[model samples]
Target: MTPSRPATAPGVREPAGTVTGPVGRLSPTDRFLPLWIVAAMVLGLLLGRAVPGLDEVLSAIEVGGISVPIALGLLIMMYPVLAKVRYDRLGTVAGDRRLLVSSLVLNWLIGPAVMFALAWLLLPDLPEYRTGLIIVGLARCIAMVIIWNDLARGDREAAAVLVALNSLFQVVAFGLLGWFYLEVLPGLLGLERAGADFSTGRIVLNVLVFLGVPLLAGYLTRRTGEKARGRDWYETRFLPRVGPLALYGLLFTIVLLFALQGGKITSQPADVARIAVPLLAYFALMWAGSYALGRAVGLPYDRTATLAFTAAGNNFELAIAVAIGTFGVTSGQALAGVVGPLIEVPVLVALVYVSLWLRRRMTTEGSGRGG
Candidate 1:
């Protein structure tokens, strides 16, 4: 059974991929997301430009190759959303072979290939930016897919299952896939690979610290919370309080990232514009293709929404961490990774409206199941 949607909280800004209310009742954070993102980007750039030597201070402190402040922001951004996941509900989703298999193919196989192709086609000459986009593709949606699913009234249980699966897979497959896409596939295609000498051990370690620690904490928190006070309290009462932290963490991270690289971004507007092209195509194609696939297979709208969203969204947090850890903080790769969410947040938010409209049309046509 799916977890019940949280009751609407007045003025409470749910995290990007975590909590959402019905469409008409979207929080200010949700509705004006593009504005907020643009604001965050602007603020960050301003901070860097205004304060001399600030970027140096921000980058000076580091833990595990990432700036300490940026790393903390990433952790804060991820934990609340991961905590909200109903990890126990995965069993319910596992039995749905069609949905599971479909998600697997869409997320792991076709999704990466599509991004790889787009990055090469659009930014063939810009290797650093291109590699960043490739990292974005390899990192599938463990975040924000749920928010899209919830907003679209998708299958919550399936969404949770898919997210959990992505999380687990990332710990293992991320390094391997990095090896393949960054090195092996390029060699086979006679394409010059990314110039950085990526150490797999380092990637894995970063994944463990960035994703693994938070995941374990989220799981333990849920378990302890439920056992002590039960699921209802854990979901409704506790979640609302901690959930807002996700946005705080996300915005904080963005600010720090921009503060460090603001000068580069402002100076090279054309390069940033170049990076945006492939990401725009990636999101649109993945969402549309997966949605069409779902309908072709005769799945209901809810699960189809889940599949489409899960397939379309990338884990920008992880991508950014990997980029920063592998490349330096100010590298073009990290900047490309940062640009990912700037595009994804607004695009997927718009898609939620599209999904709702399509749902209405399907109902009017009597194509809805059990209608």
Candidate 2:
């Protein structure tokens, strides 16, 4: 759940909350995001089960291996979130060499490895689901991380820069990493390779269409919006109106996804439950490990929180798009992608409080030591 206000350090409070707070302090829409997502899933399942020929109607038209309706949902879901990133602030974020190098190592390298290990370890029998989880790990986070950082009083500039960097790197790295993890690395480790074979070109096209196009559109929207109207208007007046669309888009996509695979999901409730275990473990391991790393490097609370959240969050939208685009819409991979947010939302919300509590404890202990 992202804040209505842009993710900047603010000293003044509005009449109600805007950019900062713990889980309870979030906006109503954002606060109940998990509810909305759950409701969407239920609705889609009902529609698919009740209505005959609905899936066929929805899939009648296709473009670039994605159904037209689903493709539109993906683009809408991604655009506003990507637009929220401050591409201009990379220099400011990069000046902190420790933060930059640490983020790259965590996001690019460690994040994927841990996810791959957990997915394989947990879901050795479920290749499609395992691949879906691995794709989730590669996505990195450019979306709701701003809200998570702000809630924990993290370095907004660092979140903005890291998110921005992720948006760009995703276009190039997503394909190569997918190839390595799904095919090469698995064979090297004597693990089962992915059941589905994906060509490099297909993965590249999926990324370009889902991430690249929206990234460019987001960059241009921010640049033009600020240049034409001042930053104040862009952030305050324009962004709030546009930001909600991302949620709408996300819900829309989920509905269509479940509609296509409703029977399969309803039949295998145990499968979804099985998927949740590794995801919970993944968040716990990533956050605890990254938070500890931040301290080991001698960073203070704000930068440390940013580092932890960035490492823990994943772009499920891109994962879903990749799964559906590469595999069929009804593939097991898409179902696993759908389950990502369900596990991630509540876990991350709890971790926000953990970060705040840790911050207070650190402050009090530091004061006592000084005295």
Candidate 3:
């Protein structure tokens, strides 16, 4: 295991990670996530196109207005991520007020606005798709981002705090933000409004189902595991065993989504590209903007990387759930949400490399300035 760093102190220049030595190397699974996701996409599309009956069977298993297969996949994907969060460290992050406030503002305010603008600019004619993109933007990330931040050797404690903060905020803000951006704002912009229903009850329920259950499970698991096996054993043994389950669940979920929506994707290949434009742009723009802002504010490299990633990543699970719940299983909105992870996994992995390069460059510059 890579040695864990101490919790960040306010305005302190702690070592982010080894600058000259090999940092944390990727596990085989981490190295191939994008490839696995692509394979799952291909298999799902093939299953949907060839075995059309499968969709009906999976779609038939509904519970609480959510598809059973989807619900299970989501639970599996989310639980491991939440389980890893160090909720106890949230209070420690408060001392670094700059990092905390900057991350929150970028994620909730600037990130959503940028996505909304890009969706309108890129897909003016496709309201459902636009609304789907907006949903992606509003639901800030809490899960996979930990993997990205870890890969980049960022401030793990800060990442944990931000993830916990974002998860709680999404439960309260996502529905209202969805209504405001997808419905009211579009109407005010004189654009065709999305027809999907944005019910606060449904949104809250989905949050409870998707995030709340997993969070509680994670908390319980941590408490029990630590009590029985000690913190080091739990972190090294128990977490390692369970952490990759989330990725497995994510790949499985992708396959199901693609299988269900294969017909639409095949029929309208151009639409996939169209939906992708705003999403790709959103990731690039938000990452660049957040990185620059963090540098301008004189944050250290690790915190800056954390802020950039936290702002750039989206909780696609929540977005997909809301899209499917609001629209139907095969709605264009849901398709947009499904495409989010497909796009995100590859894009973020690449950005992990970019962040490392940035970190090295920034550190060298700082050294030169001191000299």
Task: Choose the strongest candidate by lDDT.
Answer: 2
Candidate 3 wrong stretches, greater than 4 Å: 1-24, 196-198
Q: For model 3, give the 10-residue run with minimal summed lDDT.
A: 18-27
Off by over 4 Å in 2: 5-21
Error (Å) of candidate 2 at residue 363 is 0.3
Q: After TM-score superposition, what is the CA distance of residue 196 in candidate 3 from its true location, in Å? A: 5.4
lDDT, each prediction: 0.84, 0.88, 0.81
Off by over 4 Å in 1: 1-23, 367-371
Task: Itemize residue pairs with steric clashes in candidate 2.
Answer: none
Residue 259 in model 3: lDDT: 89
In order of listing, the candidates' clash counts read 1, 0, 0
Cα-based TM-score, every candidate: 0.90, 0.94, 0.89
Best by TM-score: 2
Q: What is the model-wide C-alpha lDDT for candidate 3?
A: 0.81
